[model samples]
Target: MGASCLTDTGHEMGSISLTDTAHEMGASSLTDTGHEMGTSTLTDTGHEMGSSSLTDTGHEMGSFSLTDTGHEMGSSSLTDTGHEVGSISLTDPGHEMGSISLTDTGHEMGSISLTDTGHEMGSITLTDTGHEMGSISLTDTGQEMGSISLTDTGHTMGASSLTDTGHEMGSISLTDTGQEMGSISLTDTGHTMGASSLTDTGHEMGSISLTDTGHEMGSISLTDTGHEMGSSSLTDTGHEMASGSLTDTGHEMGSSSLTDTGHEMSSISLTNTGH
Candidate 1:
C-alpha cells in the first residue's frame, strides 16, 4: 500500500496490510494492521489505529498505534501496550499526551518530550524505567510537576537532571539508587520545593548535588547515605529553609557541606560519629 502527493483534502486510509507502504502529503486518518514495513511521511496528519501491528514510520501531524514499531514527529496519544523501536517527538506548539500507560525500550537521542512555549504539562505516571546516554530536561517557566516516582532505575556517564528557571516541583521520592558521574541540579529562582525524601543511596567519582539560588525548601530527609569524593551544596540568597528537620548520619572521608549565604535556617540537626 503506497500513497503519495495527496494534497489539500482529508483522506482516511484504514485496515491496510502490506509491505513497504507509504502515505505522504496531506493524508489523514490512517488505520493499518499486519504490515511488515510501513512509512508515513511529509505533512501527513492524524492517525487512529486499533491493533495495528506495523513497523511504522509517522512524521508531521500523525497519530500512532497500539503495537507500533516506530513513531516520530507530531503528537500522538496511545493507550494499551506497544513497543517502539525508534523514537517519538512531540515538538509542535500545543501538543500534549495525557493518561498514557505503556513501555518504551529504545534509544531516544535529542528527544524533546515536553518543551512547549507558554503551556503547562499535565500530570504523568511512569513505572519500570531505564535510560542510557540522553539528558531529560523539564525546564519551563512557571510550570509545576506533580508527584514523580522512580523505582529500580540506573544512569551512567554524565547524565544530568535539571529543573531550572522558576519552576515548582512537587513531592519526589527515590529508593535504592546508585549513580556514577551524574549530577542532579535544581537551581530555580523565586520558587519552593515540597517535601523530598531519599533512601539507600550511593554516589562515586566526584558527583555533585546542588540546590541553590534564592528559593524556599520544605522538609528534606536522607537516610543510609554514602558519598565518596563528592560534594553537596545548598546555598542561596534571601531565602529560608522552613521549619523542617535535616539529618545526616554515618558519613566518612574529607567531605564539605555548606548551607550559608545570608539565609535564615530555622532548625538544623547533624548527628554522626565520624566526618
Candidate 2:
C-alpha cells in the first residue's frame, strides 16, 4: 500500500508506514519502515533501506539516522549517512561536504571513518580520517588553517596558515607510521616557527626542521638511523643556537638541521650514539 500527500503552505503527518509514500512542500514527520520525503522533517526507521533525501530551505531536525541527504540553508542535526549544507553533526562512512559563506559559517566536525571537507572562511573544527585540504580566511584577508590533527598516510597542505595580518601560525602535528617528508611549520614574512616533532623510522632529508626569522625556536630531536643532511640549523644575525643532539649514527649536516635568525634558541638533542 502507498500514500500520496501534498501541502502548499503547511502539512503534518505522523506514524506513516508504507513501501512508497511521497510528500512535498511543508513540515512533516515519518516513522516508516521504508518511504520517501521531500522538504520536511523526518524520524525514519528504514526508509529506502535506511536511505532518504531532504531539501530544507529553512527547517530543523533532531537525532536522524541511516542514509539521508539534506540541503539545509538554516540549521539541523544529523547522524550517520546524511549530508547537510547548513550546520549539523554527522557521523558515518558517507562523506559530509559543503560550501558555506564567509558571513554564515561555523562547524564542529568529528570524523572517525570518513573524510569531511568544507570551504568556509570562518571558524571550523575539522577531524579527517583521510586527506583534508582547503584554504580559510579567519580575519579580513588573513587566512588561518585551524588546529589540524592527522593520523593517516595523507598530506594536508594549506596555501596560507595565518592568524594575524603578518601571517602567524599556531602548531602542526603529523604522527604517521610511514615516511613523511618536508613538513613545514611557519613560512611567512616576519613569522615565527612553532615546535616540530617527527617520529618516523624512514629517512628525512632536506628537512628545514625549524627555520624562522626574528623568532625563537623550541627544540629539535632526530632519533632515526637515517641520515639527515643539508639541515640548516643556523641563524642569520642576533640569534642564539639551541643545544644540538643527534641520537642516530646517521650524519647530520648544516643543510639538513633547523636554522633560525634574530631569536632565542630552545635546545637540539641528537642522541644517536652511533655518530
Candidate 3:
C-alpha cells in the first residue's frame, strides 16, 4: 500500500512513515519492522536498511546494520560476541572476538587478536594509519583474531606479525610473539614489545628494531625484521638498523650502521656508514 503525492513507501508501513513531503515538509521513513527510520532532507537521501540503502549528498545521519552488527557513519562487523565499533573518514575497520578492539585518529594503526577455546575472529584496517603513512597488525591465541591495518606515506611495515597487540600509530609492525604491545610512529617489531616507532619527513628515513620491544623510524626499502629505518637512501638491515647519510640520526646498531639517525639528514656512501 502506498501513500500521498510524495511517493515511495509513503504511509505504506505506518502513519507519517515513508512520507516524503507527499503533503508535509520533512517526512520520515519506517522500517519493515514498523520502526521510524530516517527523515528526508531537501535534496539529500533518506535512510534505509537491509534491501534498502542510504545514499546521496552528505549522508548526514545515515546508519547501517546487519547480522546484529551496526554502524553510525562508517562500518562495523561483530563476529560471535562483539560490541560497537567505528572508524574514521578514511578506512579503519575495528573487530573483536569475545573481546573488543578500538582506535582513535592519531592512534590509527595495528591489530588486536584473542584466542581461548572456540570463538569468532576478525581483522581491522585503517586507510590512514600514520600521520600520513604506514600499516599495523595485532593477534592473540583465541579463535578470534582482530587486526588493524593503516595507510602509508612516512612509515610502514613491509610484513608485520603482531601477537596480543595494542594501539598503533604512524607506521610500525608489532609482529613476532609478544605478550603485550603498545604504540609507534614508524616501523618496528620484537618478541616482548611495548613502544612507538618514528619515520622521516623527507625520503626513506630510517628503521629500528627491539628484542624486548621498542620503536623504529625513517623511510625504507627493505624488511622490518627487528624494526629499523633508512631515510632518503638505499637499503640496509639489522637491529637498531640505520643506513644512508644521516641514516640513524647518530645511533649505530650493527657493525657498519649509520651515524646520525636524526636531522642533518643527508646522504650516505656504502663505505661511510657514518656522517
Candidate 4:
C-alpha cells in the first residue's frame, strides 16, 4: 500500500504526496528503501529522495518522478515557471510554459496570450498585466505587437487592452485562465465584449464587436464605437456616457463611463462603457 503518514523524527515511515490546485500536480510515492520515510519540508538545496526512488528538486516536482528547479517548481516546465511554475496567471511574473500563457511573462502577457501573442504585451507589460493582459478582449496583443496593424488586435486591443489590462489583471486572469478565458466582458464594466450589449436599444442586436445600437439615451453603452450619436433613434444626448429611458427625454449624459437603462423602449436598463 501507499505510505500515508510520517513521524516527527524525520523519517519516511509512510507515503508522501503533494497536490497543488494552481498547478494541477498529482500525488506519488516517495519510497526509497521501503522504510517509508516521513515528511520533510523542502530545504534550501531542494534535494530530496524517497523509497520509491522518487526525487524532487526544488518546488518543481509534479509527476511521480519529475524534477523541477524554479519558483513554480511543480507548476510546469523547469526554471522560472509561471503561476504554478510554468502556468499562466494574471499576477504571474514568470515565463508561461503552457500553450495559453496569459499574463505570464511579457509585460501584458495575459492580454497577449488571450488575444494572440505579443500584441498587447507592449502596453499591458508596462501597467496592467493582470487586468489589461486580457484587456480589449485579447485583441490588444495584436495592436501592441504590430505597432501599426491595428487589424484584429488594433480595433479591439487598443481600447479594451489599454483599459482592462490596467484594471482587472489579477482577478480576470484567475477566472479566465481557470476556464472562461475567452469571455468578451474584459473589464468589470459588466458589458459583453464584441457584442454591443453594453448599450441600450439592442446595441449589436444583430452583429458583434461593439458596432450596433443607435441612441444618445444609452451613453457608455458601447454605442458609438463606430456609429456615433448621429446614427439613429437619439435626441440631443450629451457626448459623455450616461444611461436612462430610450424615450424622447432621457437623462443628460455625464463625464462618467457607465449607463443605466430605463423603460419606454425595447428592453430598458442600459449601461455603456463610457464615451
Candidate 5:
C-alpha cells in the first residue's frame, strides 16, 4: 500500500495510479503520478524536486531554456502551487550554444520585480537596455558587438571575439574574466600601395628597409611621428599608428628617419583591414 499504479505495456490504461511509480521505459527511469518524469526527456533531466511537471520533450536540436513553472523543467521554481497544472517551463543550461541563463526563475535569474532574465537571444540581458547577444554578465560592463562574460563556447563565431591586437580585447570592468593587457597583437597585411605589386621596391615603406628601417612593414604602431597629436598621443586605450604604406608596426614603433635633403615622399593610404 506504499504507492500503486497500473501500466498497460508502458501505457497507463485504467483508473490505476500510485504516489510515485518507478517504471523503466524507453531508457527513461520514469516516475509517474499525475506527472511523468525521469526520462531525461522534456527537460527535467536533472536532480529536480518539484511537485509539478517537466516538459523536456526535445533532444539535441538547438538552444532551449526549459523552465518547470507550475512544472518548470530545468531548475525553475513555478511560484504558483496550482495542482494538475501542466504549464511547464524549459531551462536547459548544459546546452553548448553557451546557454548561460535560458532557464531563469524570475528572482533567482534576477528578481521577482524583474521578469524571466534569460531565455531568448534578446532576453538574455535586460532587453529594455539593448539587443545583447553575448552573456548576461557582459551587460554589467557594457558592449557594442561582443559580450562581457563570455568564452569561445559562447563567442566562437567572432561576434564577441576580441581583435587579437595585444591590447585589452574587451571593456575594462569589475567582472571581465578573459582580459589581456595587450599580448597577441593583430597583424594585417597592408594593401599593396605602389605599382600594384605585393612587393615593396624600397621606394616608399619598402618591404626591405635600409638596414635601419626597422624592417617593420604594414604593422600598426604608436610612434610620435613629429605630428604632435592633440592632448594625448592617443585619446583611447586602443592602439594607433601612422598608416603611411603600413598598417601595423608594433609597440610605439615609428618611422626610422627622414632624408631631409630633397627626399621624394610617396603617398600611402590609411586603412584598417580588420582581423
Candidate 6:
C-alpha cells in the first residue's frame, strides 16, 4: 500500500481490513501519528518482511512482531494475546527471564522485567530466563539481579534482584565496578528459591544484608558467625536502626553496611570480627 490516498477512482474503504493477507515491501510511510484511524490508515515499511532487516522499524500501534533483523522490540509492544517475540531474546547467548543480566562485554541484558498489569513477568530480569551464570565473575561484570518487588498482597509482587538469583526476595546491589557513579552487586539466590528462601551474603538464607546503605531493618540473629556491626551500619540519615540488627560480612565484595525492615534474623551467625 504505497501511501494509500484517494485513488484515481474515488472508492471509499472505511475499514481497510488485511486479515492474513500478506503485502510486499514499499508499504506506506504511515502518518507519523500511528493513531490516524478515521480511514483505517496503515503505515508499513515493507522492506523484506523477513531476516534481511527492514528499514522501517516503526510499526506504530495495534500490534507488531519482528520479521527481520535490526529489530527494536523494546521500543514497541504487542497486545495481541501471545505477542512475545522470543520467550528469551538477547544479543548474547544465555537467556534470562524474571532476572536482569549482562555479559562480560558489558552488554546489559534483561535490563528490566516485571509482570505488566496481568502479572505476566512477576520477577523481572535484566537477562533472559533469569539466572546468573554459576561462575565467580566480576563485582559488576558478574551476573546479578537487582530487586524482587511484590505487589501489597504479597504474592511475589515484583523483584528485579530476585529474577535470576533463584531467591524469593532481593534488594539492590550498587556495583563498585562500573564508572556510572555506583551500581549494586550483592545477592544471588541462583535458580530455585522462594520469597523466604533467600538470605544475604553468607547467611545462605538471606537472613539479613545491606539494602544499598548499611542499616539493620530486622531483628538480628542471636546465633550465627562473623556478625560485626559498623558505626554507621545501622543508623543512616534517612533510616534508623531498630533494636535487633545484623551487619553483613565486608568480605568478598559484600556490603559494607546493611539492614532489614520488620525482618527477623531467625537462624544466622554473628562473630565479633568484621569480614
Best lDDT among the predictions, by candidate number: 1
Quantify all predictions' global Cα lDDT against the true fold.
0.35, 0.28, 0.26, 0.23, 0.20, 0.23
Candidate 1 clashes between residue pairs 3 or more apart in a chain or in different chains: none
Off by over 4 Å in 6: 1-163, 167-180, 190-275
Q: Is candidate 1 or candidate 6 better by TM-score?
A: 1
User: Over 4 Å off in model 3, which ranges?
Assistant: 1-99, 102-127, 130-135, 142-161, 164-202, 205-247, 250-274
**Candidate 3: 10-residue stretch with minimal lDDT:** 78-87
lDDT of 4 at 218: 29
Displacement of residue 109 (Cα, Å) in model 1 is 7.2
Candidates, ranked, TM-score: 1, 2, 3, 6, 4, 5
Q: Measured by TM-score, how close is model 6 to the native structure? A: 0.22
Q: Which runs of model 5 end up more than 4 angstroms from their true locations? A: 1-42, 49-100, 103-129, 132-158, 161-275
Q: Write the per-residue lDDT of candidate 6 for residues 35-95, one digit (tens) a residue.
A: 2112222232322221111111112112222221111112111111111111121121111
Candidate 5, residue 61: the lDDT equals 14
TM-scores for candidates 1 onward, in order: 0.31, 0.25, 0.24, 0.20, 0.17, 0.22
Candidate 1 has an lDDT of 0.35
Residue range 209-238, candidate 2, lDDT tens digits: 322333333333333334454332322222
lDDT tens per residue, model 5, 1-275: 12222222222212222122212211112222322222222323322222222222221211112332111212222221112222222232221111222221111111111122222111122111111112222222111111112121111111121111111122111111121111111122212111110111111121111111211122222221112111111111111222233333222223332221111222233322221
Summarize candidate 3's per-residue lDDT along 1-275 as a digit string, tens digits: 12212232322222222222122112222222212223321111212211112111111112222121211112222111111112111111222222222232322223222222212434433232233122343333323333323333333333233333322322223222211112233232322122232222322323333221222323322122222223222222323322232223322233233333343233333332333
Which candidate tops TM-score? 1
- Which scores higher on lDDT, 2 or 3? 2
